[model samples]
Target: MKIAIIGAGAMGSLFGGRLALAGEEVWLLDVWEEHVRAINDKGLAIAAADRDIVARPKATTRLEDIGTAELVIVFVKSTATAKAAETALSLLGPDTAVLTLQNGYGNAEAIAAAVGAGRVIAGTTAQGATLLGPGRIMHGGSGETHIGELGGGLTARLEKIAACLTRAGIQTVADDNVASLIWGKLIVNVGINALTGITGLKNGELAEHDETRQVLALAVEEAVRVADAAGVKLPYGDPVEKVLAVAVATAQNRSSMLQDLSGGRMTEIEAINGALVREGERYGVATPVNRVLTLLIKALEKLPRENRP
Candidate 1:
């Protein structure tokens, strides 16, 4: 498969490296010139539990440099989804499948707007990676990846894509209810990311303290209410419990929002918690906790680099 990964950040680098090592033709495209140059010069380096695996995948900062691809995996920041989709037009062929495993909501719709609904696949992944440096990433943990068509059916193409991902060690499943899966992950992120970003706590640390745990629970409960009002059924039976379990499981891992703030970069808060607030307003559901979390994160985003927690 000719694969093109847009936004070759931590997640992008991880996927491209693994797939390229699996003998797939992978090309990583990103706006980071130094990262692209490093990948092109020295290959992508992925540090796993066992060893450091380096895979030579084509990479470029220039969108025009990429040829048409069969599969394009979008891993850009949620705030950049529309722009990423617009820029990704250069890599799309008629039959190309565009998959978004990004954080937050409306990514599929943004891509569908650019490439048509027939070519869009919405999904979520638990496989975590952390960027160590240019073209270098650490595999933070391994988890399931669920993908499905936006129209809600398990098609042959979906199965093939899942198989491709599984074969490359991504552990993917073709789900009929991908919206639920996406919401499930989003709910977890809603609880964890903002708390971590504000307090500088790791995933597991959120559960250890009653103070942080209360904030986490309230945020998730409000999000669950909004999701219920919107008629999006989450996959988890008890989303709060599931989120806490995930925090323990990925205890040492830092949330991506924390990583963004720590690096003095912008975050996906507008898309994650902010999206929840927007949906809550549309559905006439009160989301005070989520609204407050969103505001607090935005406040944190305003802090000077030296003053940030």
Candidate 2:
């Protein structure tokens, strides 16, 4: 299969490297010149708990270099989805599948506007990765990946992509109700990401403290109510418990939001918590906790580097 990763960041590089190691023809496209040059020179170095290996995948800053690809996986920040989709036109063929495993809501809609709804696949992944440096990535954790058509149902194309990813060691499922999967993951993020981003605490620490745990429960409950009002069915039974379980499972990991804040980069608060606030208002559900978290993160975003919490 010919594959193209639209954003060659940590997650993008990890997926690209795994597919390349499985003998797929993969091209990593990114705007970062330094990262591209490093990968082209030394290959992609992947460090994990059980093993370390270098996978050779083509890397480039130019989209034309990749031409048309059979699969295009988008891993860019939610803020960049629109621009990335527009730029990805050069690599889209009629049969190409555009999969977005990015964080937050509305990504599928944004991509669909450019690539057409029929060609877009929306999904979520529990896999975690961090960029150690240029051309180097750490596979921090792994989990099931779910994908499906925007309109739902188990299509042949969805199963084919799932099979391809599974063959590359990424356990993927072609779910019939992918919206539940997306919303389930979003609720987990709503409970964990903002709190960790604000306190600079590790995932497990949120559950360790009573005060933080209570606050987390409140935020997750509000999100659940909003989801209920929106008529979205969550995959899990207890949203708060699910979030806590995930935090405990990934105890040592620092969330993407925390990593962004610490590095003085913009966080995805708008897409996560802010999206919840908007949905809550639209559905006439109150989401005070999520609203507050959204404002706090936005305020943090505007602070000077030295002034940020």
Candidate 3:
């Protein structure tokens, strides 16, 4: 298969490296010149628990160099989804499938607008990865990925892609209720990401403290109400319970938002929690908790390096 990874960041490098190691014809496309040069010169280095891997996948900083791909996997931050999809249109073949494993809501819609809805696959993954440096990533943990067409039905294409991901060591499930799956991921992020970023706590530590737990509950509960009001039936029966469960499962991990905050990079606060606030307003649902978190995180982003918490 000819594959192109659009973002080529931490998760993008991890996914592209695994597929390249599995012998697929993969090309990693990114705007970061340093990372691209590093991968092209040496290789993508993945630091794992038991072993480290260096996979030589073709990489490019220029979009024109990417060529056409049968599959394009988008791992850009949610804020960059539209621009990434627009830029990636040059790499799509006539029958190319665009898969978005991005966080938060509305990414699929943005990609669909650029690449056509029929060819878009909306999905989420629990897999964790941290970028160690240019062309290097730490495989934080392994988890399941779920994907499906936006309109919701299983197709041969979806199944085939899931099988390929599984072969590359990512356990994947082809789901019909992909929207619910996406919402489930959003709930988890709403509960965990900002809380972790604010308190400088690991996922497990959020569960250990009463104050943090109350804050997490406030965020999750408000998000659940807003999601329900918007007609999104979350897959989990009790969304708060599900969020806490994921906190336990990935206890030692620092969230992507926290990572960005610590590195003085822009966090996806507008996409995750801010999206909730936006939807809550549209549906006339109260989401004060999410709104507060959104504001606090945005405030933190503006802090000077020496003053940041």
Candidate 4:
């Protein structure tokens, strides 16, 4: 299949490289001119725990260069989803599947508004990667990726995409309950991303420190309450424990929000924790902890680069 990764950041680069290595026609599209140039010049380098290899995938900054793709994976930050969807018109064919494996909520809706709801696929991935430099990435870990239709139910397109990803070495499942899958991932992000972004702590460090762990628990529990109020049943039980287990499992990896802060780029606080706060208000649920985390991250975004921690 011909694939286009809309945002060739760490996770995007990792997926594009793997698919290219698997002999798929993959094009990485991003605004990072240097990174795109590096890939086109030398190839995309991926360092896994077992070995390192350079995968040859086409890279470009201009969407028109990609023409029409069989599948367009949306990995752009949530802040840029609307604009990205609007600009992605050049890459969409009639049968194109637009998958959003992004960090937070409302991404599917934004894409649906542009390309119609039937063409949008909603899902989440647990795969972890870190951008070492231009055209280079470290594969921190691998986990399941789930995709499904927006309205729910297993469809041929969902299975076809899952099979393609699985063949590309990304373990993917075509699940019917994508809504729960998204909220499940959102709860995990609520417990980890903001705290790490604020304290500059690694994933496991959040669980190691008593104060941070307590705060993580409170934020996750509040999010769970809000989810319940909205009638969204999360796939997992004991959200707090599940979140801590995830933190410990991916102990050494930096949360994406922390990565944004370190790079002096804007973080996706509004989509993650801020989404919880807004949902809480709409549902009449109190999310004080999430509200505070959202406010702190938003404040940090406005600080001058030298002034940020």
Candidate 5:
């Protein structure tokens, strides 16, 4: 399979390298010039669950560099979805399968609009990864990925993609209601991301203080209500409890939103809490905490880059 990953940041690089190592022809495409040069020069440096690297896979920033790909997996930030889609359109002919595994909400819809719903399969992955440096990615956590068609119904081709990911070490599951699965993941992220981001602390740090716990409760409560109204079933216990449990599980790890804030890059806030607020308003259901988090993150985004750290 000619697998291609767009946005070769942390998770993208990790998957690309592992697949190539597993004997899959993987191509990594990124917008960052330095990263492109780094991978082209020094094979992707993976240093977490397994060490060392694979150099056979090729990488580039130019869309042309990513010729025809049978399956294209998008891993770019949520905010850059449109741009990536516009650039990636050239890489698709008619039968290319395009999948998005980026965090947050509304990703599937955007990708579907870009490349027709019939060619899109959305997935949510629990496997955690972080960028250590140019071309270096640290895969720190173990998790499963659920893949399915966005608007329901599936085929032999979806099965083929799932089989390939499973053999490459990314535990996989195929579900028809992939939309609900993605929402479940979004609820968990909304519960944890901003609280950890604003406090400049790790996930476990939220449980250390009552105020953080309160914020978590407020966000999850409204998120659950919003999700329930939207007809989605979460995969765990109370949304808040599940997120706190995840916070405790990933205690030492910093939330990715916080990493973006610390790096002065735009976050996926709009797709998380921001998505909630927008939906709540559409349904005439208020989502105050989500609104506040969205505002705060936007405020943080407005700050001069040098001052963020």
Candidate 6:
């Protein structure tokens, strides 16, 4: 299939470059001029646990340069989703499937606003990547990706796309209830991302501190209540336990939110903790811990790069 990877950051590069190496027609679209130039000029430099790959995938900053594709995977920041979606509209055909494999919640809804619900697919990935430089990404951890139709139509198509991803060494699951998967991902984000980000600590550090553990439980409890009100299921039997388990699994890894803070790139706070806070107000779930966490992260967001912790 002709594929377009919108937002050609580290994760996008992983998907696009690997797909291209697997002999798929892949185009990477992004606004980062240097990243686009690096790929188009020198190819994308990719290194994973299993192997190192250099893929000469097509890349461009021009939205017009991205033509029609059977699938478009969007990895843009939640804050920039609307603008990215507006630009990516050019690459969508009547049968094109647009998927958001971003870190936070509410991305699918935003994409649906631009491309219609039937064409928008929401996805979640646990794979981690660190961009060492323009056109270079270090695959830090292996993880699964789940994709599904938002308006509940393209099960077969998403399954086929999952096959392609798996063939390229990115394990994928096509689920009918993708919202549940997204909510599960949100639970992990709410538990560690902002707290670790604001504290300048890694995931394992949270468990070592009693204060952090208490706050984590509080925030996750509030998030669970908030998610329940929205009719979203927490994937694990116990939300707090599940989130802590994930923290243990990726103990040494810095969250994408932390990585964004380190790189001075914007965080996906609005779609994460902010989403919980908004839904809390809508559902009267009283998400005070989540609210405080969101406020703290927003404060860090306002600080100058030198002042940011």
| Best candidate according to lDDT | 4
Please state the error at residue 11 of candidate 2 in Å.
1.1
State model 2's lDDT. 0.90
Q: List the residue pairs that clash in candidate 5.
A: none
Per-residue lDDT of candidate 4, residues 1-309 (tens digit): 999999999999999999999999999999999999999999999998889999999999987888999999999999999988887778888899999999988999999999889889999887878899999998877778888899899999999999999999999999998889899999999999999999989888899999999999999999999999989999878899988888887677788998898888899999999999999999999999999999999898888777665
- Return the TM-score for candidate 6, rounded to 2 decimals: 0.92
> Compared with the true structure, what per-residue lDDT tens digits does model 1 show for residues 156-214?
99999999999999999999987797788889899999999999998889999999988
Clash statistics: count for each candidate: 0, 0, 0, 0, 0, 0
Model 1 C-alpha lDDT versus the unseen true structure: 0.89
lDDT of 3 by residue, 253-274 (tens): 7788988888888899988999
lDDT accuracy of residue 44 in candidate 4: 96
Q: How does candidate 5 fare on TM-score?
A: 0.92
Q: Residue 141 in model 6: shift from native, Å? A: 1.4
Deviation of model 6 at 105, angstroms: 2.4
Model 1 ranges off by over 4 Å? none
Q: Which candidate would rank higher by lDDT, 1 or 4?
A: 4
Q: After superposition, how far is residue 241 of candidate 3 from its true place, in Å?
A: 2.5
lDDT tens readout by residue for model 6, 25-121:
9999887899889988899998766788899889988777767889988887888888778876888788888888888888888888988888888
Which candidate would rank higher by TM-score, 1 or 5? 1
Against the unseen true structure, what C-alpha lDDT does each candidate score? Answer: 0.89, 0.90, 0.89, 0.91, 0.82, 0.83
Candidate 5, residues 1-309, lDDT tens digits: the string is: 888899898889878888887899889988788888888897888776445655456888777866889999999999989877776688896689899988888888888888888888998877667788887777756567888887776778888888999998887888778868788788878888887778788777898899999999999899888888888887676778877877776676677898898888988998989998988887778898889988988888888877663
Which of 1 and 5 is ahead in lDDT? 1
Error in Å for residue 306 of model 5: 4.2
The C-alpha TM-scores of every prediction are 0.96, 0.96, 0.95, 0.97, 0.92, 0.92
Which ranges of candidate 4 are over 4 A from the true structure?
none
lDDT of 5 at 202: 79
| Residue 29 miss distance in model 5 (angstroms) | 0.7
